[model samples]
Target: MPPAQTTAAPPSPAARALPAARRSLAPDLARGVMLLVIAAAHAHLFALMATGTDATLFGTWDRIATGTMTLFADLRGYPMFAALFGYGMAQIHRRRSEQGREWPWTRKLLRRRGLWMIAFGAVHVALLFFGDILAVYGLLALVFVGALRLSDRALLGSAAAALLAASAFVFTITFAAGGVPQLPEKPQGLLGELALRLSMWPFMIILMTAATLFPFLIGIWAARRRLLERPEQHLPLLRRTAPAGIAVAVLGAIPQALIKTGVWTDVSAAVGAGAATLHQITGFAGGLGYAALIGLVAVRIAGRPGPIATALAALGQRSLTFYLLQSVAWAVLFASYGLDLRVSTAAGVAIGAAVWLVTVVLAELMRRADMRGPAERALRRLTYGTTAAHGRAD
Candidate 1:
């Protein structure tokens, strides 16, 4: 009898893509969808504020919608962005080392990126929304440069610790202060709000720094683990993670939902506000879970392109452009001089979704034309110090 032959199994498409795939369409597709969710929350808040209504019947419906929005808001976008940022940084570091270049240059490049982001974010906050994230992300990226050399285990441990400590600190401070601080009894005029935001800059830096860095570390860790490299290897992890992520997200949301709905009395309000820290903690956790789930889905859907993924990838590829565009559109629609729609809770959501849909469609069209979103094109020029190269915009 002929000797039996043994063969190794072929690499799954996702596994084959591995490290290279991090820069491919998958992560960008996830980011594109996640950004829409972020936009929806912001837009909805602005729309509701503009409407200037309380929790009437319509308001009640809005609250329900807002509650749902909160789930997505709390668990989407930022973490994924942070993670991918970390992964990109690592890849850059790896490429540099392979090329026998000194690593400090990468740090310098990241610092420049951070500064650019800060400048961009400042303009965004001043002209658009005060809640802009780029400045925060930029500053946090500067901080993460120090952490780049840490092993994956150290990165993960440090991230987890920082998250827990930050959550506890926020909760303790808010509780000791007797509640979450408000903008004051009277609406601070626009200038006043701007002043208030500036006043809170230190705290904002602290909060956002912790929030951004930890997720970034996790992303670095994910890259090191080849989690994105082998989606099937991580599927079991996702199955366990997704349910827990959803549960934590729901639990974290319950107190905030109750407070927003007026179901919690003063005593409960105190308890719930303290518990809102859990919301932030779980929100981050849930965000991680969702990222894992998306990765798994991407693996399954690899080599089988769908409209949704294609559209999302386009948006993601041009994320910088879309991100800036979102701020521009929101400012025109919601700022004091524009539509002046300051609608707070529910209505903000509806408007946000509408804006996101518009942006997505426009992005898709732009991709078809082989044109990158203007902001993205500019950023690429700045980052690479060269004219744009030909490829899908994303």
Candidate 2:
């Protein structure tokens, strides 16, 4: 059991808002890069309105773009995010518990944070991106708050079981139903698009929540182990898992790459569904691999991470703000209220990459000025209360 310090009151929220002097760079760095992958993945999904990546009309470069996105970006980015979510949650829980905050109060704080996330997500989905994950994560945090208390064995077992079951469920659904659910059509009018977004909320929320649970659980497990937080201590383990996870994830994703690239476009429905399932099943590796690789990088730079690393880490530090901004860029480029333009897959990916670069520069500016993201500041205040939310600009 953790030693208790209930005698002393917890630190003021304002003071707590300050950055950790010895913060782990791995998580922030990983998240910093992860957003790019996410942006690219999401951009491709929007591009789907134009045509399938594998469509015969696509030029060689387009096909190559689709294949690259398929193998490296799609079905791959979410795992890292999910794992990080769990990792961060564990950190929060542990910090409070160690500080002598009773479980009841801490859990309440977490649930409240989750509630705010849901609200943010609703607004985000309604106005900007249909692929928002904030609300799903918010709901997951609330639903799984109690799971943090579970023993390591229980957590790992549950994660494994969920992984298998979720994969099977997705596979079965695709296999039986022919493909995934149909998305709501893009509306040319701003109001119409908002309405369509709100309409699709129920289905998309359900899908995102269920699909991401496995990684969330794994994240919790990793946090308990302090995997990312203490990379130096876990180097041996990281070295082993990093390569293995990538290999599995890459290999498993091959079938998906083939289908998405149109190389195996003519396969039977059932066969195609199986390929999709294979991608889902193996995606765990991708998520785990990303975290591990980042962990290794963090270790290497434990002493000194130069300007580039510092900038990336800053972006990761304020990931929520950047994440939302990514959609805003997408909207201007693709939504009716904005450019209302559609491009080939390759072009879209390039656009996504360029937009992400913009954020990197923005993040560096924030870092240089020592400012926190506006969204993060608001969230901190909301979660902890006005006085408690007091923080430096950075």
Candidate 3:
């Protein structure tokens, strides 16, 4: 007798969460959230620096606000963004292969994006803040493009090893030298800073390149495992990952926090720097942990539709526009050449929240009108070299 015909199971809830032809909304939403946190951090920095009175109505709140910001910075966001970037590259590769197309063009596309980003970042740094990450990310992307062909496991392992080695190297040099090298003490004025940054670009590129690789590798791993594609399959893994990540992040941040708070004295600084070598270990552990937690959250939220999540996803879809807009807005608000509000801690938090709210509302409105942000549309056109009726603004 012929064996009974085998039947395939229906797609699971998680599997259905994302369209087969499109990338996951969860990653985009996660990116949007990271951008908001970044804005908040920057706003706080501006307020702290610009406030005339050393103390104000918001002054008392700085400790808590600053602490929270510092914690968030150390725990998530940056790493998540980096990992997502790598994941995105993988997605591009997979899609191209599925279409029976060569991926060399994609490399050129990425390079173009990187070059553009570096150009934008330079303007941002010169006109706004020297701490901009765009240039760093752009430079790193160029490096990561070469690693796209590595097997997922190989990519992950190599990235991990590189992070460890780089961190070790940084810690050893900094400790031996008595501390991390910082920009010279007096604000060298804007032109001076620009010149200095240009001179130091090579070193910055190297450091940022190493720092970005691990996250990119993690992204590639996630794509290979279909982690983002099917979040439910990874729920149990995420549950275990979140708390572990938080613990590791806390551990990694302790030495830095102690030094910042004066709890670690000059004598302790030396000892702490030595101990901080362990920070690299914790950073890797915690960064991956947070990424896992966020991925898990995204998985859970995938099935249940919520307005906020939808709005965030919209923002993520148009992230390039929002990102550039934020930079422009911040430059206007904080730069000496612009309005230069430089209000205070409390005001910064308020402004950040306002920016987030406004961005969300604007993003939702644009989505409703079937419009992508101007910058995003332009980038897509440049990358794809086809207008193709994409990004219809209403």
Candidate 4:
């Protein structure tokens, strides 16, 4: 006899949290690549801490490696991450609303997530890496979501205001300091270190948010336009933006690159500040340009989803987990308390790339196994309670 007709169970909220069938490839792809870029960007900080100056830290491959990083990776990754974070935040809100979650509920969920993020970031910085963006993002998520309710014109205007104000503030400070000033302090003990890191966090977040405001704003704007979500629909815009944004970013970043590579080591403080101010101001364009370029790549890979892209996208999907992993790796390899490994400019980059590559493999494996990264799973469970995660379905 035919078995009693049975029904399939619905997808769990946990499963639903995974990208739906209609999930945009562009964002994931962009995020995956962004991690690598971020990894590269972060390596310099470790190197900087080890040797004091980012310009002098390189052992042998000084000019070429640092120069390459300056030209391509430095000051480029954070903006992309910021913009993408804003975009993802918008997506989260939109998805919840579409799923019939009320504003109050959605807002509460975001705040909870933001709180957890701040907690995680604090812990991360205390234990592992100081150059953590998680906390900054957590803070941003809490503060920036309010702007989502604004009208399009208001939102854009606010973003512009934020960017301009941030630039002006930083520019004035840079001008006062004479150029990209360095902040280095020696902590007496682990406790001192912890306090110092926490103390430094707020200022860093505020300053960083301002510098990267354009990306966050554009991310929100792009999300509203569904640009990344519907890449096919925005090809023209992406195509035009990809090159233009990149050009602006590169030109703007050149001064920093020159300084970083010691090409003009003796520039006056004012000149140095001027170069830094240019770099910071132009970084917005760089961040947006990078996103546009990634979108264009996604468009080209429309029919053919290659293994590399697939791996990158998987890495992107579990980016938070891998991002944390990067910090762990840095702690293990670079921190004074850890191995305290020091190497040439090229080697630091290689190490960072290697860590990121390891994550790509791990993430891809998890993707294939239909499992989430441990951090991701924890965050998801925290973000949406176990019952909701298990019972609710999209």
Highest lDDT model number: 2
What's model 2's lDDT at 2? 42
Select the stronger candidate by TM-score from 2 and 3: 2
Considering TM-score, where higher is better, how would the candidates rank from best to worst? 2, 4, 1, 3
Tens digit of lDDT per residue, candidate 1, span 41-132? 66765665555554333556676876676565744556677777777667656554444445576577667767777777777766556566
Winner by TM-score between candidate 2 and candidate 1: 2
Model 3, residue 323: what's the lDDT?
74
Predicted model with the maximum TM-score: 2
Q: Sorted by lDDT, highest first, which candidate order results?
A: 2, 4, 1, 3
Tell me the lDDT of candidate 4: 0.77
**What is candidate 4's lDDT per residue for 1-394, written digit by digit as tens?**
2122311233334545634345678888888998998887677567666655566545557677787777677778778888998898888888765555666767888888888988898889878766678877777778777866778898889888987787777778787887767756534446765777778777777777676566777788889998887888988899999899888988888888888777778877778777877887777787788899998888889768788888888888778888988988887777666777666667778888988889899988987887766787677678887754432212
TM-score of each: 0.84, 0.95, 0.80, 0.90
The 10-residue segment with the lowest total lDDT in model 2: 48-57
- Candidate 1 residue runs with Cα over 4 Å from true position: 1-23, 48-58, 180-202, 268-270, 342-344, 387-394
Model 2 agreement with the true structure over 44-109: per-residue lDDT tens digits: 777766343333468888888878877778878888898898888888888877667778888998
lDDT of 3 at 356: 73
Quote the lDDT for 155 in model 3: 80
Q: Is candidate 3 or candidate 4 better by TM-score?
A: 4
Tell me how far the alpha carbon of residue 252 in candidate 3 is from the true structure, in angstroms, after superposition. Answer: 1.9
